[model samples]
Target: MATTLAEFEAKVLLDQTLSTNHKSIIIPIELQEKEDSLPTNRFNKLFKLLIIYCLVLLVYPVYLGYAIYWHNINSINISWCEGLGFLLVVSTLVYTCLCYSFVLSPLVDHISFDIRFPGSMEKVIQSNEVRCAVSSIIILGCIIFLIIDTQDDRYRLVSAGGILLIILFGFAFSANRKKIVWRHVIWGIFLQIIFGILIMRWDSGRDFINCIGSKVDTFLGFTDSGSSFVFGYLVDQKPFLPTKLENGSLAKLVAEEINNSTAVKNIVVFKALSTVYFFSFLTSMLNYWGILQWFVQKIGWLLQTTIGTTACESLSASANIFLGQATTPFIIKPYLGQLTLSEIHAVMTGGFATIAGTVLAAYISLGVSSAHLLSASMMSAPAALAFAKLFYPEKETSRTKSDKISIKPPSEVNVLDAATQGASSAGLLVVNITAIVIAFIAFMSFINSLFEFFGDQVGIHNLTFDSILGKLFIPLSLSMGVEWNDCEKIAKLIGVKVVLNEFIAYRELGLLIQNEELSPRSAVIATYALCGFANPASIGIQLATLNSLAPQRQADFARVVFRAFISGNAACFLTACIAGTLYNEFTYVQL
Candidate 1:
């Protein structure tokens, strides 16, 4: 007989009463049979949902492929593929929402599955063994495929294999092998590969990403205009026309020379740093209008759905694309107290892996490609969660599992007030960035001077920090498919970024690009490698910022901050590896 809700509740009460009663009572065989069927029914329902979700995921990709084929056959632009992807994404989201609201919500309270099995150490050891064997087979297969496919210059393919091995070994050596989740690591690598292929290889993907990059450049150009209005000729780089003196006096020449010197000295301040304020203000106004929140939620939902991460980690990860690491924590402030250690690690790692949108303009000003930078920012979101999970798997259960993201608006006032507040907030950021640049640059110079002095005494007069770092990190750069000749140069940039910050590294990269010192492939790889906040200074910043927001988790933050820094570096390197593997030198054009 089928069980009713009333019968189920009555059975539950009877079981409780039987347990509490000191005297043993004989239970009816029919009731026991009914109870056994209840669990089976719940499991069947859950299994069905899982199967349906899997089918839904599978069908969308198939549909996307078919749509691309149809578009190509009809002589339509392949760009429609992106639209189809978006439509599928929306459909999946709506389906998920409906299922949760009408089906999962009620069933969740009635059914619970304990996925953790009983065997502990034996299971873990066996699991690790299987993981190592599978990973080795995959790596071996890839190397063999590369060797077989390339008729000429096969050594480069072998070198790529070696590089991949070294990166895997480096991360594995640093990670806690017992606690590391190899599945997450493998998935992370796969996702990075997929992202690189889509963004760099496929025509439709390239067009979509390029369109976004162009829009970003256009928006930044608008910000530049505002900066020019406020700072005059200082913010905008324009040719100066000298005034013709009526009498051709020496005083006129002196005045012109003074003006020229001032302009030259102020160029860095005006051209690079000043535009940040305007962009920040615009971003703040968008946040106030709910536009930024909507975008963040959609992106966060995607991450959560795919990566199986908590809402807080997912939201903060997505926010890092548009906001600074320091600013992203505020988006999920209410849920900070309830986040597990692993979730917090993901948050911090994501912050370090990607950069804020306000600074993209500054990097673009330094000659980095807008499309590459934007791609790195978007790809790092999933990569961050992947590495974070590998390094520190979630041990404690999360208190909240709702997919909905809660972002507190930055302002409740009018647009003018919002703009004013945004500008003010941006002013502080400008001062902070300026101070960091000056202090770090001066400090590195001092250290380099010491290195030079010691090296000169030892007959190595050309020795400097960059050269030292280059030598130390050449293997790492080479592993990213950088040419042997340019490995030192790329390595030096990576070292500088890790030791100092991405700003300094990007500045040096800009100089290298201007001098044509790096090949196009190498330049693209370096851009991805350096697109992060994974440096010594960021640890302190994260600690201070997150501690202020979630003071109770100070101990937790301190414990994972250093690991997060390492994970951040790994995340950027993963992106770089994918870029090096898929990116064609012929396709890259300086923007």
Candidate 2:
């Protein structure tokens, strides 16, 4: 054993191999003493706790004071409560990080397979089945919310079964409870309150963050101006797709409106609308031209400096492998591999809860009302945080030294290289979008056909997959304040989002609005719900992305992807729920 140990230590020192599988060479600690040898900093933990407690002490009182002064409760009161929830979220996150790092990880380090069981508690926690079970709960929550709220019943049984499976799996295989510490939980909440207090107390700091967010958004909008222009132009020129939007009630309405309009003879007005389309084409061409790549990077950097980069798209990361998932988080690459699991989850969830720049034009073209686009984008940011935490409470092994954001600028020998790279990425994006649409549409069509046949034989008229999905999710939609009858319709809309993509879902939403199948509130909720790309495909994308970045941590990356996906999807839904509930509550109060 001594000879083997010496040989392994020597091999690791020589650095001959870097594969994670060669753990014997890479990790020098003897199996028995690994726990004792692991690093621990009581001050860091205590200091973090102190910071959290201080911030919380500072913020909640102001909110309470405001609530009292108003004498009438309003969204501000709800905002305070939500703010508390946010603090709880942060506190839990901090606690999760501390415990995972200080407690669970040491357990993992010391455990050796020499024993009969041959595994650490962390190993138990890391199981795919365990992760999947946890994930299923989060996903089922989303699905349940969708079914109950959207008014669809087609997949009610399936969703219910999924929920049952999640519960059973969770009970049967719980994550290692040995890692948890009561202090961590209390400290997490305390820290959240402290941060909340800081946010509340320093109006200037709070404003600064909001201001930074607003400015970044404003700049993004400006940069996307060309793309938006192109989208509008296409709408004016194409008016309608030949394949989509058949000659039906909606078509007749558009035709009648156009025929009755007198603007056709006015060449000036006609040309103006035509010009908007021209710009839309130009912007769409630019998106494909790689202009957005240049601008998003430039602007992403400016935003990072102001808001702390890892919070969004940091500018200090690598930009290699620009074609695949690697490119998505390249803006925050410097922080990757080093981030605490919570932070990594934050980045992943943000990506999941928000659409990629490649498809922003498509969403715009899909008939999202312009005002709603901004609203959707803004809503997605916070929603990402809410959902990410719920699904994957950060384990202890995940921690980072700082909050610095990082990104890697495009490395090009010349302007042409930059343009070429951008165009290639754009081309690939176009192909990906086109392929996804065709495949998903076909898949849905096949599903509908099979269901239609079965339904017809059974004397059911609306027995499509969507209908079942809608039924299952209707109750959740209602909880979000969607009318009971309208819940199924919205549920189908969300089902489409999960199974296929948000673009199709939004397109369906526009039609629903035209058909008056949704109220204004429902439309708003639907928009929020469908703003993100938190679907199953994204899980594969993130796993591949993170795995490539830290090849050594590939197993860890893969293990967590399921949880990340659930967290991402749930984050978007939670955002929608918050938006829906608040919007409805406010609207009722006004009435």
Candidate 3:
């Protein structure tokens, strides 16, 4: 044994291949097949060319259809502005989807849809069957209550079930499960529920929120003054192009009101997005004047005392209400270095779980009730801290726990300088949003084409990508207390929100509202669910921002960022559950 020990030590010391305490490395390399060299023959070249041709051939014509949809490739002369927008839209959608799917959304460094299990566990059918049976039972219980139970009790039960499932999911993915503090988690859920009761059930609460929403709506409406002054009637009013006009070459397309009493609205997408600049300008002045800082400190204090998060994490989360994700870090910039993994996760999750005040006007312009939107964002702030802590419990002492921080005023010369900076910064956001819409829309077309083709082969019509994803969300929608038949439509909207962004989802929701396809109750629930910025691209966005702020913790951020992304999404879903529970069917939302 002494000789063997000496040999092990000698091998470890002299040879890098051996473990420090063993003669040979104990960790085995995963078994994988070595790949053969690629053939450079004519056949290989031809095969590669064929694939490229097929792919381009398949997705290219969808572009033409998209152009026609946007009134770009019209029956007569194509409008240059619309034509340019179509191209930009397609290109942006493609890039956004590729960037998100390939790079940003991965749970690991390499993108993978994989899991680990033991060989023995694989053979355990009983465990697998038991879980399936239990989930099915819970779903059944929800359905049964839908029929016999009182409306209030039924929705409350479904809401309870949905939250239970979400909490279970948190436990499953928790980083340090044994260290979870239930008090923190419970407060998060309970606080979320309390906000839901206030905004959705209490009459006075709803009225007050609505009053604030009205003020915000009116404030955003002021953008039209600047828009009309700069862009003229084109920005002031919606185009009156009929859908049927695109079908005829003889049709003369004119940008005029159809009649004295037509209901033409904001058809031009750019018009809605223009609000970003004005809101950005306003927020910049507020931040510069230290007004925003005052709000952040008060809100941050409230979140910390109630949720028990570190000062930095709490301040960052609270700052998100009035500030952008990247800017919020500066509010606690001095302490970014001292945050633990759990605290860092909280900060990142807070960013995803809420929208910046800059974009609130853009979202509100999409026909969502201002009251619901504001409530969703406010309710989500505390929920973000709670869920972030739940998924990544504080195993290490947070160095900034006792530290106090305040929002730092922006480094700008004067009011106009701050406004200029804010509006200019919004331009980049506008460009990014446009790109995301275009890229995802084109990708969706390609995916829908594939799905529809396969669905046709199986003799099933209407099997687009959204529809398929909608089916996946059926259980989730049901848990949100949506009606049985209405589940698919709401679920599909949720699907779009997840795969693309909330902006598109809200736009789609607006369309559903105009068509009267979604019920009032489902609309309210969808409003709450679709409130956050928790999508794939946002994972990359948060990482990029936080990585720059704390370069030393990049590896740690990479390990837990995906969990933060999911936690953000779940936090919104929890908010929806609470809304659905207390939703008054008789009371209508002012959309």
The number of the candidate with the highest lDDT is 1
Q: Give the lDDT of residue 368 in candidate 1.
A: 83
Candidate 2 Cα outliers beyond 4 Å, as residue runs: 1-326, 339-343, 397-399, 403-405, 413-420, 457-461, 584-591
- Please, what are the lDDT tens digits per residue for candidate 3 over residues 189-242? 666766766776677777668767877898899988988677754566544445
Q: How would you encode candidate 1's per-residue C-alpha lDDT over 1-591 as one tens digit per residue?
A: 356888999999998887866244345666788999999999999999898877766876687678868877988653322465555555677667767766897999788876665688658766858767877886676556455644444434533564366356546755455666655666566656667768887877887787777766776777667667777767644334457554477867766766666544336667777668778888888888777887898888877766667888888889999997988998888888888888888999999999998888888877788899999988888888887887777777888676445666665578778877888988887788888889999999998999999999989997889789999999888887888889999999999999988999999998998899998888888999999989988888889999999899999899888889988998888778767766555564443
TM match of model 2 to true structure? 0.50
For model 3, name the residue pairs that clash. 89-438, 92-439, 93-438, 93-439, 93-440, 94-439
Q: Is candidate 1 or 2 superior in TM-score?
A: 1
TM-score of each: 0.72, 0.50, 0.70
Q: Which candidate should be chosen as best, given TM-score against the real structure? A: 1
**Relative to the unseen true structure, what is the Cα RMSD of model 3?**
24.6
RMSD of each: 16.1, 19.9, 24.6
For residue 410, model 1's alpha carbon misses the true position, in angstroms, by: 4.6
